[model samples]
Target: MSPRNTRPTTPRSGTRQSPRVALTPRAAELVRRLRAEHGPLMFHQSGGCCDGSSPMCYPYGEFRTGASDVLLAELGVDGVAEPVGFWMSADQFERWCHTHLTVDVVPGRGSGFSLEAPEGVRFLVRSRLLTDDETRRLGPGGPSHGDASADTSAHSRSGGPGRA
Candidate 1:
């Protein structure tokens, strides 16, 4: 006989939190422009240097936030009754919200958010760095995705203004 699927079919229980991020008119406009250009955006909190918490936005790909195994204490976010679309730590999610950005999950690539920027340039933030190949995929006017190596190399050699 075929083995029965053991995964829990029941949907997790929890209240849906309203997206309460706030943005200036300029920022909102920027978000709109980016949405019009790119298909969707993603948001995430990752383990980084210092306190080990940093927020990142992505243009594509699937990412998990607020998973069952994640510890609420570590994330530093509160008032969450259930795991949302992603497996973000409570604290990190709070920080993203504090930035006044709204997160959305798309059907194909992944989940992300749109932010309005005062500057005319629309920016894309991602949890992971973009590979050189991925940057090429962006066609034109997209932010750099790969390592800081590419960005820092020129500055190191130039010893420009900020350098000693």
Candidate 2:
């Protein structure tokens, strides 16, 4: 099967934790292709002014993340054993604390710095507010609620949302 043919691994009952972000069939395929070329990759939603406010894909470690950033989710790429991380600035997270984000792609140009620009497509975040049950799970601050780190078998190496 073409790498693109792979589907997002369906989350199974009693088997996996809810993902912070997910990919559509199309986005997953693109990621598979990009990973083959770029090596491991990660996503950072531009915090606003400085980074152009577009979700960008980068070779892990190519872009710098720090304490000011919040780890939103660690995504499982369809054909890759390693998970891709998704992050937002701490400030940006404040506005989106109640929403679930999905990393999707469309045909167009995104931030010039994002690795996919040359491919003529860009990644976008599709969001929805968390349900009451999900909010309860969150408790307050941090991932999957307070515990930003989880051993959900979804990350590239460290099974967590990757701290900046």
Report model 2's TM-score to 2 decimal places.
0.74
lDDT for each residue of candidate 2 in 1-164, tens digit (9 for 90 to 100): 00111123365321112434567767788888998998778777886785556788987656566556666666675566576666677778788877777667889887778999999999887889988866765555464211233222233245333334
Report the lDDT tens digits of candidate 1 across residue range 1-164.
Answer: 00011111122222222222222333334434444554343334454553244334433223332221121111101222111212234444444322223332222222123232223243322333434653443344311122222211122234421122
Alpha-carbon deviation at 76 in model 2, angstroms? 1.2
Q: Any idea what lDDT model 2 has?
A: 0.64
Q: lDDT of candidate 1?
A: 0.29
CA shift of 17, model 2, Å? 7.7
List the candidates' TM-scores in order: 0.29, 0.74
Report the Cα lDDT for residue 62, model 1: 30
Model 1: lDDT of residue 163? 23
